[model samples]
Target: MNDMRIVERDVDTNEVKIAARDVQVFYGDNHAIKDVSVDIDDKTVTAFIGPSGCGKSTFLRCINRMNDTIDVCRVKGDIRIDSEDIYDPKVDPVQLRAKVGMVFQKPNPFPKSIYDNVAYGPRIHGLARSKADLDDIVEKSLRRGAIWDEVKDRLHAPGTGLSGGQQQRLCIARAVATEPEVLLMDEPCSALDPIATAQVEELIDELRKNYSVVIVTHSMQQAARVSQKTAFFHLGHLVEYGETGTIFTNPVDPRTESYITGRIG
Candidate 1:
């Protein structure tokens, strides 16, 4: 039975990176997310798993206030990153997003060159003082994204010219160029082939060494492979959250068990 549990790795610290308390999201009259509370640890990968329209992705967007972009969407309750209230009126959403970077389902790189694609964030955030500094940032971010080797020779090439996997990696580089504390991914590999999915999964593991990673994935296998913690959502509610192994092997909630065993989704 012990062999059935997934091995949990040690992280840099036990400190909570992002904390959400009784969060609720409403799109017009529809309550999209309901009362989700969780403490996501620093330097760890946390995966949100649930059926479509279960609010897992909705909750992920709440961490970085991405939902704010939708005019009809309204978020309620406290969400803090490193103990700072991100919802405070004084906090700038743009600046907040820089601190908490996000990668969407599809690879949407800028129409500019690969170098410019990765450099855009740092340039906009004023992270570099000189051209040399900007160049270094671009190189480092691409290396961190795990695609520097493939595209190093074509730094000036159009970003959209890359293969699907490479473009996704470029987008990741763009996200990290701002040196965000948290990385939010919404089904980042759904558009990729198996080889690309494997590469991104490997990158996700490496990324947890520096930033807290929160991913919304429909694949339970991907969650078990990449995350230390797993969260299950159902019909706008967070049903269970705990160590990934425990959630998969010995879930306390019947709903989670049903979902895990394919009885319900």
Candidate 2:
């Protein structure tokens, strides 16, 4: 356990960025997620790890109401952000999404120029006031996404024309442009090469300083490398949730230990 990337306590969770209590998700007859509750802290990186179809992604989406898009998906129980009930009727899903950004498994950039793609969110959310202001936002977001140097000269180039990894980074820039308080990445590195994956992983760690970052990744080593806290899911239940080092080295649940040890996943 001493060799663990980290085996220490330095995080403060009293400030919850997202809270889910007794949460459940149903896609028609299939229960995708079971009763689960966890307080995701502000300015922290939390990883969700589990076997395929185990419901990590489903639960991640719940934090941002991504599940609302599907006609058949239904969520039960309480979910809140900043101590405000997110599921309340007064909370618009569109506005809520702006507060909680998401990056997907694949890089799905808008089919416009790179500048326009990064500018899309701020434009819609009315975050930019003038042309110069918008330009600053675009540059700042690209810098935060760590792709400014690579795409700076190609501002007018189509976003889809970039390499797969670059496109993913562009998508990330687009997400952060809106100044979301919480960022959710669902297998964001699944489609990238190792180098690209490493770049994105580094960005994820940096982003935790500005946004609560929640990631769902299959790689146990990736979780240990990037996250301060980790949640292990199995068969639609959160088997264990704790510090990344402790979870990887001494998981309280046998299922989590099995998944991390390569016995089952």
Candidate 3:
């Protein structure tokens, strides 16, 4: 990612990086996400945990406006980053996506060389004007993804040729290549083995130092281990959100407690 550009800006850690109010998501006739409001701080990891169909992923997609790709999906609410209205007609979705990169549940790397895969975003976004610039961006991204040492030997190797864990890390490196300020992940380690999951979890922690990271995971334990703030959603409603310690040990909502205790999903 073009993290160099971010250094010039005044990144206030105390200020809210993302703020959503009365957010609602509807898929055709079904309301997938009900009115939800939450503030996500900069340089922090926020986890969204819930059962399947609980709308956690749906809401995570809302942060990056990824739902716009679905014709039947409609998002209505105020979602702002740096106090700028993302829903404003003047805002370009393409540019918005570049600033808010996303990692999907599966590792969907481009069927291109490892170098090309990481360079793709920087090229498309015009973040690099020269070959040297692109090369630097690719290396920095891979380092940030924490996989450079493993794959730097063969930059031209097919990205699909790597192991499952490597592929996921490459995908993450690809996301970071765009120099996004915020990273949204949807069950990033679901398909990974335990060892691979641990690697991604470690990378997620490292990422929060530079970009605000928001993750949606079904694994409560993983969320507890990685996130500073936790938001629990149930049946499209935000059940509880607070400090990870409090949400796990002393929840203000019974639904949250039930889900945490295994009595309910």
Worst 10 residues of 1 by lDDT: 1-10
Against the unseen true structure, what C-alpha lDDT does each candidate score?
0.93, 0.92, 0.91
Candidate number achieving the greatest lDDT relative to the actual structure: 1
Candidate 3 collision pairs: 1-177
Ranking of all candidate structures by their TM-score, best first? 2, 1, 3
In candidate 1, the residue pairs with backbone N, CA or C atoms under 3 Å apart (3 or more residues apart, or in different chains) clash, namely none
The residue-by-residue lDDT of candidate 3 on 183-261, one tens digit each, is 9999999999999999999999999889999999999888887888889999999989877777887789999989988
lDDT-wise, the better of 1 and 2 is: 1
Q: Model 2: how large is the Cα RMSD against the reference?
A: 1.4
- What TM-scores do the predictions have? 0.97, 0.97, 0.95
What lDDT tens digits, residue by residue, belong to model 1 across residues 1-265?
Answer: 3422655545455799999999999999999999999999999999999999999999999888899899999999999999999999999999999999999999999999999999999989999999999999999999999999999999999999999999999999999999999999999999999999999999999999899999999888888888889899999999999888889998999999999888997
Deviating ranges (above 4 Å) for candidate 1:
1-4, 7-13
TM-score of 3: 0.95
